[model samples]
Structure formats: C-alpha cells, structure tokens
Target chain A: MARCRALVRPALVEAVGRLHPWTGEMAAYALGWADPAGTPDPTGSEGKGVRQALALLGAEAVGADGAEAVPGAVAVELVHTFSLLHDDIMDADALRRQRPAVWKEYGTGPAVLAGDALLAQAVAVLAEAPGRHTGAAVRRLCGTLNDLVSGQAEDLRFEDRPWHGPGAVSPDQYRSMAEHKTGALLGCALALGAVLGGAPDRTVTALDRAGRHLGLAFQAVDDVLGIWGDPAVTGKPVHADLRRGKKTYPVLVALAGGGEVAHELVTLLSSGRPVDGEAAELVAALVEEAGGRAATRDEARRHLDAARRVLRETPLEPTAARRLDALFAHLLDRTW
Target chain B: MARCRALVRPALVEAVGRLHPWTGEMAAYALGWADPAGTPDPTGSEGKGVRQALALLGAEAVGADGAEAVPGAVAVELVHTFSLLHDDIMDADALRRQRPAVWKEYGTGPAVLAGDALLAQAVAVLAEAPGRHTGAAVRRLCGTLNDLVSGQAEDLRFEDRPWHGPGAVSPDQYRSMAEHKTGALLGCALALGAVLGGAPDRTVTALDRAGRHLGLAFQAVDDVLGIWGDPAVTGKPVHADLRRGKKTYPVLVALAGGGEVAHELVTLLSSGRPVDGEAAELVAALVEEAGGRAATRDEARRHLDAARRVLRETPLEPTAARRLDALFAHLLDRTW
Candidate 1:
C-alpha cells in the first residue's frame, strides 16, 4: 500500500499537470494538492489509496512490476476524483474533507470544467500508455464510467422516491446502485492493472470480480460509518447520510420489515426534510432496533467472504495476492 | 454532404443507444433524436453535418470507402453534442434549436450526466474499433477533449475579464479558444478518420490542419451570424451574442480600435446587461463603422484560403479532394 502510494502521487501529479492551468488549479484542490485558498498543501489530504493499491497489486499478481501499472492506477484515481467533483455539484455538497467542495470554492461552472478535464486526462494517460493492452484497458475504463453515471443517476433518483410501498427503495436496488456507483471503478482498476501487466484473460476476470465484491463490502462499511461512525474518524457530521435523507442500506433494511418500529422509522425518514438533532439519534436507534444495522453488517460480511473466496481460488502470485488481501482488510478494518 | 448525413444519423442513434436510459433520453433530445417530452422526433433538429462529412471525406481522401470511417465520424459528432449540452448549462441559455436546452428540460445534474455519457461513448466507440490504429485514434480524441475543456475554461473566464485592459481578452486569445473549443474536435474527426483509413502520419497531420483552419473560418462566420444574421435563418434571436455579452470576433475587433466608436461600444457593452432592441441596433452599427465586420470577414477568408492551400498541397485522391472542397464551399457558402 505504501509502495503504490509512493508510485501514485508523483505519476498522478504529472498526469493532472497536463490539464489547462485554470482547470488544473481546481483539480489540484479536488485531489488534495491545495487548500481552498489555492495555496499548495505539501502534506496532501488525499483519501486512502485503495484504488491505486488495488491496481498495483493487480499488476503484481500477474508477476509484473507494479510500476508498469502506473498509468492504469493514475487513470482510476482520476476517474474517482472526477466522480467526486461532479457528485458534489449534483448533491450540492458544501464540504469535502472538511474543506469547501470544488463547486463551493470555484463556482459551479468551473467545477464542471474541472471534472471534465480530469476525466479527459484519465482517458488520455491510459490511451497513451505503451502497451498492446492499452486499448482494451481504455475500453474497460470507459465502460465503467457508463455504469458509474447510471449508478449516480439512480442515487439521485432515489431521493425522489417514497420511503415505503411498491415504489419504495429496496435492499436489492441499493446493492445494485452500490455495485455500479462504487464497485464499477474499483473493479475496472484491478482489471485494468492486470491487463497492463499482461495477465491472461481469466486472471483479469477473476481480479475484477474480486475487486467488485470488495467494493460492495467497502460501500456497506461506508454506509454504516455515515450513520454511526465517529465524526473525528469519518471526517463528517455524525449521522450525515441520515440527515441528508440518503437511501442507505441500514435504513432501508430496517424499513423493509413493515413492523411498528419500521412504520415509525419510515415516518421519520419520509418527512422529506433533513433529519437532525435529537430526531437523528432516534432515527439511528430505530434503525438499529429494527435490525437495519445488523442486516447491513451481514451484507458486508457476505460480500467480503465472496471476495476472499475468489482470491483463494485464483492462481495469482502468492505474495501479491496476500498483500492485496491485507490491503482490503485494512480498508474495511472492522471485519478483521 | 447528403451521403455523409445519411451515414451519420443512424450510426449516431446507434452509438447514443448505448447510454444509460435516463441519460440516453436527454442525449436523444440534445441530438435531435426526440422531442422535449421524450417522444421520438422523426423530423430531427440536428446541426449541419459538417463534422461527419469531414470525417467520411477524410477516409475517402486516403483512398478508402467513406463507410470505413463511421466510428470516428460517430465519435466526433457525439463529442460535439457533449460540448453543446454542457456549454448551454454554463451559459445559462434557455433555448437550443427553438427548444429548451438539455439543462432546462431535464435539470442540471442529469444534463451533466448526459454530456458525460456521450463523452464516454465517444472514446469507447473509437477504442473498440477493429484496427491497429485504434489506440492512436483513441489518444488523439482524448487529447482533443482535454483541449476542448481548456477552451471552455478560457471562455468562461473571459466573462470575468475587463472589456479593455491588459487583462482583457485579446484577438489572439479568442482565436486560441476557438481552436480549442471548436477546432480540436473537428481536427480529430478528420485526423482520426484518416488514421482509421490507414493513411500515413503526414497525411493525417495535413487533414488535421485543414480541419482546424476550416473550424476557425466556420467560427468567424458563426460569430457574424450571431450579431447580424437573420433570426429566421439562424433560428435564434437577433443580436443573441451581443445580448449575452459573449466575446466574438467582430465585437472584439471593433473594441480594439482606440476611437469614438470603440469608446461608446465599450460603454454600452461593459454595462453588463443584455443589449436589445434600439441599443443592439446601435451596437451593430458601431461595430460595422469600426471595421469589425470587414475584419471578421477578412479573417474568415484568410483561414479558408489556408485550408484550401493545405488541401491542394496534400497528395490526396482527386475525386475525394474535389468533393471535400465542394462541401467546404457549401458550408461557408456566403463568401463563395
């Protein structure tokens, strides 16, 4: 993980530098290279390098130097950054990493351009990479972007949906959205890394599946944190997703029971307003009491186990595969 | 032109069909595939088939069937559509093609996603093409997208600059923006089409230059139309560009002169309100008196001549080259 981070930051910087100066500044802020005031932050505030680590480990699993996967790693990270920038604009999210979001700091139009530039950069870096596999990798990444956009469309559409009845959000629907929104990019990262590493087709497919399962597990963990994790650790308002009326796994699972507690939980969440203060705590408690929290944990465990099973079955380089397993464990640390 | 349009429409519809359904609907509306209420529009409202015609003719210029260049043609056309959808959002323009812009009809977030999906599909179609040159084509298209974003960034920033100062938008800067925003994709269309048709690098580069020159000429013509063309012919309100305070060739050149007309022109334009009715007519007259109209026409002719010179110099197929010249004449028909 540390090694991939070291390889990633410099290469990522070079890739992003290819953008226009104005858009580059906004992108720098989005990727944690600068503060909201546009001053450089030497101590960068980037997310844990899960996508990059998975990419490098994917290359290593095919017995290639992880350095060979640098372009794919940079590409996936940029796509992730692109999604964050645009998602904030769509969601009207005011803060990112406790700083002003890109749209907030730079205005909506500039934020849109910044995101577009990053996505362009992502495709450019990979397409220009020297490899017979680069074309396939580019197609894979582009296809993932299609799925990611669809997932986001659904996520936004969910807000307009009722909290219960035939039109209500379901666990199955939430899982599919998670798979598309978060899992598709993560899956592409590992698969693209393997392709760049010159892995066999079967190995690439296996790694992609493994990464997707890991992505779903990671998303469930994130949903849990959004509601119950410590704000000091999560870097967000406590019960932030609940306050936003986000259709997360725990709350939906809790509501699916159709009992009195489920009915009461629905009433609170269906009010079409930001659930806050004492009401937020009660909402959380009701979700837990209705078994939403436990159901979510079980879903996480199920996906994580599936990922582990796939890894065990695949004939990857032992050391690299083990490292990947350790990395996933570190990401969703509660399971371990 | 008719043949290329025939080839382009169905191919474009097929390509756009690959997008997520919701986004696909908005893109369909943007591309003249459907009406605002999402009904199919058999009488399509698409733009002139300039880019598509250029791409197909490029292949034929390289001694291949025009049909061979379908993917590249489709890709460039989608990129153009993507830009229009996003540009309308940034400009806050309510109308496009006598109807609501994508953002107005579908809302901003979905509009953003719809544009993104088209871009992804653009790169995907090119990368997935069956040829040895597919990689180079993908890289070329992606690089063009980066430039397109930069061009858009500059255009938006120009709005914040003073009308006359060191920080003012220069003719040179406007030319650069026009190249990036408008020319890049057009250049890629011709260049990628030639590449896919198996042309040598030099030939590909020549077509790219021709397309860019043609783009500059086309933009100048469009700028003139924005201010002075018949609204019935242009399908837009009279003085639309002046009303919106857009930086265009004639207006910028008119403002460049240090004279009475320039001073009054600056005063009227710098007030930062939409110029309309009698005031708009006066601005038009002042621009004409300051030699802006003639200067713009001269600039367009200069670039068009350069494009012709390049085409004459290149060793392309005679039949295709003649056909391409005719297409150019038909497009910039006024001067011809």
Candidate 2:
C-alpha cells in the first residue's frame, strides 16, 4: 500500500493542479497536500490509499509491473476524495481525520465547487491516460461513479424513513448499499488495473469480484469500529454510529432478530431525541447483548475468507498472492 | 438553434437517463424534460442550445454531415445543464426558465448529486461514442470543464469583494470571467465538432476562436438584457442585475467612468439596501446616461463582427457560411 501511494501521489498532485487556480488550491487542501492558504503541507495526514493499493495489486496479479496502473490509481483516489468532500457537506460532518472538514474550513460553496472540480478532474485524468485500454478504463470508472451516486442517494433517502416501520432498512438492503457505495469503486480499481495490464477478461472479472468482497469486509470492520473503537485512535467518538442512530449493519441485524434487548434499543433510539452518553452506552450494551456485535464480526470474517479464496483461485503468481494476503491482513488488523 | 435542439434532444434525454434512477430523474427535471415526479412534460421549456448549434455548424463548415457531431452536441449540452444546476444552488436563485429551479423543487442535496452524475455521464457518453475521434473529443471536453470551473470560481470570488472599493470588479475582469464561464464551452463545442469531422488543426483553431467571440457577444447581449429588457420577455424582473447589486459588465463600465451620476449610483447601490422599483429605474437611467449601456451594446456588436470575420476566414463551404451567418444574427437579435 505504501509503495503504491508513493508512486501515485505525485501524479495525483499534478492532475489536481490542472484545475482552475482557486479550485486547484482547494482540491489540493482537501487531498492533504497543502494548507488552507495553498502552502504545501509536508506533514499533513493522508488517507489510507486503499484504492491505489488495490489497483497496483490487481496489476501485479496479472504479471504486470504496477507502474502501468498509476493513472488508474490516481483516478480512483481523486474520485474517493471527491466523494469524501461532498459527503461531508451532505452529512454535515464537522471533523475529518481529526481536523475541520473541508466545508468547515472553507465555506460550503467553495467546498462544493472544489468537489465538483475534483470529480471533473478524475474523468479527465483517465481520458488522457497513456494506455491502449484508456477507453474501456473510462467506461468502467463511469460505471463505478454511477454506483457511488446511487448508493449515496439511497443512503440519504434511508435517513428519512422510519427505523422499524414499513420503510425501515433491512440487513440485505444495507449490504446492497454497501456494495454500491464502497464495493463498486474498489471493484473498478482492480478491474481497471487488470485491463491496463492487458489481462484476460476472465482474470479481470475475477479480480473485480475479489475487490468487491474485500470492500465488504473493509466496511464491516469500519462499522464495528464506529461502534466500539477507541475515540482517540479512530478520531471518532465511541459508539458514534449508535449516538447518531445510524442504521449500520449491526444495528439492522439486531433489529431483525426482534429480541427483548433489540426492542429496548429500538425504543430508545426511535424517540427522536439526541442520544445522550448514558443512552449511547446502554444502546451499545443492548446491541452486544442481542448478538449484533458477534454477528457483524462473523460477517466480516466470512467476506475476508471469500475474498482470499477468490484470489487463490485466480491465476496469480505466488509472490503476488503472498503480497495481497499480507496487505489484506494489515488492513483488517489495523487499530486506527 | 431550434433545429439543433430538436436534433440533440433525444440523445440528450437518453444520455441523462443512463444515470442512476434518482439522479437520472432529477437531471431530467433540471433539463426541463420531465416533472419532479418523473413524468414527461411536453410543454417544458428548454435552453437555447447555443453550444449544440455551434458544434453542428462547425461540423457542417468542415463538409461533414452535421449528424456526425451529435455526440459532441449531446455532451456539451449535458455539461451546460450540469453547470446550470450547480450554479443555481450557489447563486440561491429560485427560478429558471420561469419555473421552479431544480434545487428549489428537489432540494439542494439531490440537485448536487444530479449535477455530479450528469458531469460523469457527459464524459462517459463521449468515451463510448462510436467514432475514431472519441478519445480526442473527450480530452477537449475535459479542458473545457477546467475553464468552466475556473470561470465559476472567479465569479464566486468576485461576489466577495466590495462593489465600489479597491477590489471592485473591472470591465476587463468581467470579460475574462465571461470568457471562462461562457466562452470556453462554446469554443470546445466547435473544436470537438471540427475534430470529429476530420478538419485540420488550423481550421479547428479558427473555429474555436470564432466560437469564443460568439460566446462573448452572447454574454454581452445577456448583460444588457438583464438591466434593460422587458420582464415579460426576459422572464426576469426589470433591472434584475442592478437590484441584486451584481457587478455586471455595464455596471463595472459605469463604475470605471467615475462621473457624478456614477458616483451617486454607486453610493445608492453600496448603501446595502435592496434596490426597489424606483431605485432600479434610477440606476438604469444613470447607467444609460453615463454611456455604459451604449458601450456594452457596442462591445457586443464588435464581438459579433469579429466572430463573423473569423468564420469567414476559415475555409468553410459557402452554404455552411450562410447558415452560420443566419444563426449568429438570430442569436444577437433575440428579444429574450
């Protein structure tokens, strides 16, 4: 992951700099490459570069040097950052990565424009990418964007529905949303890398499937952390999902079971008041008592196992397989 | 322009429908093709399709059937509508084409998502276009987007400065902004059409120059209409720009003249009170008396002449030249 990030960061910065001056500066700040005033920030924190890592790994799996996938890596990362910027505004999130969110640091209008510029830049990067497969790569990226937009629209609509009524979210619906929101781009990253590496269509499809499963596992673990991880480490408040009454996988799973604790949890959450600290603690305890935590953990493990099996069945070199396995372990085991 | 709109409307509708369900519906509504409930509205108003006309005209100028540029036409129109959607939100305008704007009818969140989807789909349509020049066409579209973003950023930034202070907008600055915000896409339309029609680089460049000047003339006329046109014809209140304290080209020109009437006008506008019926009429009289109105009209005429000269110098077929001339006259002569 670190190697892939090192290779793609400079190109990503160059691509972003191609935007109009004000937009470019705001986009750079959102990507952690610069301060709010457009000065370079050498010590700024960066994202995990998960999509870039997946792109490189997919390329390597097809017996190509990962350098061929640098454009795809940069394109996916820009799209990811674009989503984050707009999502922060839509969600009205105040903080990100332990700092003020883009919409908070800049005004909402500028932040929206910055995100708009980044989105355009993402497509532009792929369109100008130097490769024989550039056309197919852009189509795949567009498909991913469609899924991302659909997923986000669904998520926002979900927020307006009753938690336990006819329109209430179900676990399957949650998984589907997760696939569209998180899994689609991850899948596209691998597919783009494979296509750029001149892999067979079958191998590319296999890599895409593996990526989707990996994305599911990633989001499952994130959901767990959102509920129980140390706030100091995660940069989010403990039981954050519960406090916000977010209908995450665990909460949906517990709600489906309809046990006494599940009913109590639902009653407390659906009251339409801000969940105080004590209510959050009690809700978390009730969710755990209803087997939600263990169920979610099991789901993550299942996805990780499935992803590993898919990769093993693919015709990847032994070294590539080993590297992918190591990275998977690292991602799932990370404390932060 | 009506002919071009008729030719591109189906393709544009199909392209917008390629987005996710919710986003596609909102985009359709924004484009004035459907109602908020996703029902088709036969009487819905549409844009002038100026960019589409330029693309088709450019194609014809190069001796290709105008149909060859339909994809480019559709792409540019989608981008134009995308900009309109976002700009409406940023400007907080409640109406467009005398109807409730997309953001006003559907809310800002969905409108933003719809715009993002349209932008991606614009590039996607070109990438999947069935022609040898698809790659180059996509690149040109991206470059145009860069200019559009920059133009919008400058326009927004200009709003932050005082109207009569040192940072007040200048006529040259307004022209530069219009060039980016309006001219770039128009230039791109012609370039994309020329490229698709297999025109040489020199001819493409000339067409682009012609398109840019045409765009400038269009905007100049628009600025003039914003202040002096009848509300019944323009679909906006009389002197709408002055009422909003917008530093339009004529206003900037009047400010730069620094006459006694201009000084009084500035003081009245800068007082921060809303310009009512009497004030709007007074400001209009002052601007006209200061020669701002005449100057702006002259500027538009000059640009129209320049655009015509550039088109004439290009080695266009005789019939194509006649058609271009007719369209140019129609655009400048429109009352609304």
Candidate 3:
C-alpha cells in the first residue's frame, strides 16, 4: 500500500495543480494536501489510498507495470474526493478527518464549485490520458459517475421515507444503493486499470466483479463500525449513526426482525427527541440481543468470502494475486 | 437560427434524457423541456439557442452538413444549461426565463446534482461522437469547462471587493471575465463543430476567433439589456443588474469613469438598501448621464464588427459566408 501511494500521490498532486489555480488551491485543501491559504501541509491527514492501490494492483495483476496505471489512479481519487466534498454538504457534516469540513472551512458556494471543478478535472485527465484505451476508460468513468449520482439521489430519498411502515426502504433497496454508491466506482477502478493494461475483456470483467464484492464487504464493515466501534479509534462519537437516526445495516436488520424490542427501538428513534448517551447504550444492547450485530458481521464476511473466491478463480499473476488476497483480508479484519 | 434549432433541439433533448432518470428529469425541467413531474412540455420556454446555432453554422461554414454537427451542438447546449443551473444557485436568483429557477422548484441538492450530471453527460456525449477528432473535441470541451469555472470564481470574488477602492474591478477585468464565462464556451462550440467536420486547423482557429468575438458582443448586449431593456420583452425585472449591484460591463465602465454621477451611483448601490423602482430609475439615469451606457453599446458594436471581419477573412463557401454574415447581424441587431 505504501509503495502504491508513493507512486500515485505525486501524480495526483500534479494533475490537481494543472487545474485553474483558484480551483486547484481549493482542491488541494479539500484533498488534505494544503492549508486554507494554499500552503502545503506535509503532515495533513489523508485517506487510506485504497482505491489507488486497487487500480495499481489490478494493472499489475494483468502483467502491466503499476506506474502505467497512474492516470487511472489519479482520476479515481479525484472522483472520490469530489463525491466526499458534495456528500459532506448534503449530509451537513461539520467535520472530516478530525478537522472542519471543506464546506465549513471555505464557504458552501466555493466548496460546491470546487467539487464541480474537480469532477470536470477528473474527466479531463482521463480524456487526455496517453493510452490506447482512453475512450473506453472515459465511457466507464462516466457510467460510474452516473451510478454515483443515482445512488446519492436514492439515499437522500430514503431519508424521507418512513422508517417502519409500508413506505420503509427494504434491505434490497439499501443493498442496491450501496452497490451503486460504493461498488460501482471500485469496480470501475479495477476495470480501467485492466483496460489500460491490455487485459482481455473476460479478465477485466472478473476483476470488476472482485472489486464490487470487496466494496460491499468494505461498506458492511463500515456500517458495523458506525454502531459499535471505539470513538477513540474511529474518530466518530459512539452510536453516532444512531444519534443521527441513520438507518444503517444493523439497525435495519433489527427493524426488520419485528419483535417487542424492535418495536420499542423504532418508537424511541422515531420520537424525534435527542437520543442521549444512555438511550444510545440501551438501543445498542437491544440490537445485540436481537442478533442484529452478528447478522451484519456475517454479511460482511459473506461478501469478503465471495471476493476471495473471485480472486482465487481469476488468472492473475501469482504475486499480484497473493498481494490482493492480503489486502482484502487486511481491509475486512477491522474490529467488529 | 430556426433551422439550426430545429436540427439540434431533438438531439439535445435525447442526450439529456440519457442521463440517470431522476437526474434526467431534473435536467429536463431545468432546460424547460419538461415539467417537474417528468411530462414533456412541447411549448416550454427555451433559451435563444445561440450556442447551438454557432456550432451548426461553424460546421456549415466548413462545408459539412449541419446535421453532421448535431452531436457537437447538443454537447454545447448541455454545457450551456449546466452553467445556467449552477449560476442560478450561486447568484441566488429565484427566476429564470420568467419561471421559477431549478433550485427554487426542486431543492438545492437536486439542482446541484442535476447540474453535475448534465456536465458529465456533456462530456460523455462528446466522447461518443462519431468523429475522428472526438478526442480533441473532448479535451477542448474540458478546457472550456475550466475557463468557465474560473470566470465564475472571479465574478463571485469581484462582488466581495470594495466597489470604490483600489480593489474595485476594472473594465479590463470585467472584459476578461466575460470572455471566459461567455466567450470560451462559444469559441469551444465552434471549434468542436469545426473539428468534427474535418475543417483544417487554420479554419478551425479562425472559426474559434469569430465565435469568441460574437460571444463578447452577446455579453455586452446582455449587460445593456440587464439595465435598460423592456421587462416584458427581456423577461427580467427592469434595472435587474443595478438592483443586484452586479459588476456588469457598463457598471464597471461607470465606476472607472470617476465622475460625480458615477460616484453618486456607486454610493447609492453600495449603501445596500433595496433598489426599488424609483431608486433603480435614478441609477439608470445616472449611468446614462455618465456615458456608461453609450460606451457599453459601443463596446458591443466593436466586437460585432470584429466578428464580421473574421467571417469576411475566413475562406468559406460564398453561400455559407453570406449565411454566417446574416446570422451575426441578426444576433447583434436585437432591440437596444
């Protein structure tokens, strides 16, 4: 992961710098490479570079040098950051990575414009890529963007639906939204790298499938952490998702379980009063008693197992395949 | 103009419809092709289709059938609508074309997302154009987007600067912003059409220059209309620009003139009191008395003449050159 980040980070920075200077500066701040005044911040916290690593690994698995996939890696990262910027605005998140969010630091208008510019820059980067598969890569990237927008739209719409009634969002609906929101981009990262590396269509498709499953597992794990993880490590308040009345995986499972405890939980959450720490603790205990936590963990393991099976069947180079296996295991082995 | 609109509008509608359905519906409504419920409205209000006309005329000037440039025309129109959608949000304007703005009709979140989807769809449309120069076309389109964002940023920043101090935006600064915000996309429309029609590099460059001049003239005329045009015809409030304290071309010209009338106008505008009908009339009289209005009108004429000269010098078929001359004259001959 460190080696992949070392290869892709500079290229990503350079690509962002190529934007219009004002927009470039805003993007740099949003990406944690610079302070609000455009000064570089060497120690700024950054994301895990998971998508970049996936792109490079996907290329390497298909017998191409990882460096050749730098453009794809950079483009995906830009798109990811763009999503984060807009998502923070829509979700009204005040903090990110233990600092004020972009919309909070800069104004909302600038943050919105910065995110739009970043999306355009990402497409521009791919459109100008010196690769034989540039056209195919752009098409795939646009499709992924469409999926991301659809997923976000659905997520917003879901928030307005009744939490426990005929109009409630089903588990299937949640899964579909998750697939579009997270899985599509992850799949596109692998597919883009595979296409750039001259992989056959079948191999590219398999890689995309593996990536989708990996993304699902990753989101499932994140949902678990949202409920039960330590705030000291997670950088989020305990029962943060519950206090916000978010219909996360375990909460949804408990709601669907349909018992006295589930009914009480729904009434308590829907009452619109603040869920204090004690109430949050009681809800968490009820979710555990209903087997919601264990069921959610099982779902994550199922997807991770499916991802590993796909990797085992795919005809990747032996070293690349082993690295991918290790990476998936590391991603899924986070605390329950 | 009618012929060009006839050729491009359907393709434009089709391209927008190809976006994700929810986003597509919002975009359709924003483009005035549909209502909020996703039903088609054949008589819906539409823009003047100036950019679409430039694209088709550019192709015809290069001896290609206008239909061959339909994709370019549609792409440019999509980009144009995308800008309007975002600009309305940034400007906080509640009305567009005498109707409620997209952000007012739909919520801000959907409006922003729809605008974003439109931009991505525009690039996707260009990337899939069945032309040998599709790659170059997409690159040029992306560059134009960058310029547009920069122009918007400058426009917003200028609003925050002191109108009477050293930080005041100059006439030259206003011209640069107009060129980027308006001219860049118009030039790109012509350039994309020319490239798609297989025009030689020299012809493509000449067409781009003509389009830029035309765009500058268009914006100059628009500035005039913003202050003095008939509300019934223009579909905007009388003295709309002055009411908003916008740093339009004529306003900047007046500020730089440094006369008693200009200074009084500045004081009235900077006071931040609502510019009611009587106050707007006074400001308008002051602007005209200071020669700002006449100077702005002359600026429009200058660009119109420059665009005409470019058309005369470029080697086009005699018939096509005559058509281009008439088109430019018609565009600039709107009621003052």
- Classified by CAPRI criteria, candidate 2 counts as medium
Give each prediction's root-mean-square deviation over alpha carbons. 1.9, 2.3, 2.2
Q: Least lDDT summed over 10 consecutive residues: which range in candidate 2 chain B?
A: B41-50
Candidates' C-alpha lDDT? 0.88, 0.85, 0.85
Candidate 2 ranges with C-alpha deviation above 4 Å: A259-261, B164-166, B258-273
Off by over 4 Å in 1: A271-274, A334-336, B271-274, B334-336
Best by lDDT: 1
DockQ leader = 1
Stretch of 10 with least lDDT, candidate 2 chain A: A327-336
Winner of 1 and 3 under DockQ:
1
lDDT of 3 by residue, A223-322 (tens): 8898898999889999888887777778888888889988988888788888769999988888888778988888889989998898899899889889
Report the first chain's TM-score for all candidates.
Answer: 0.96, 0.97, 0.97
Docking class of 3: medium
Superposed by TM-score, candidate 1 places the C-alpha of residue B314 at a distance from the truth, in angstroms, of 1.4
Which DockQ values do the candidates obtain, in the order shown? 0.81, 0.69, 0.65
The deviation in Å at residue B16 for candidate 3 is: 3.0
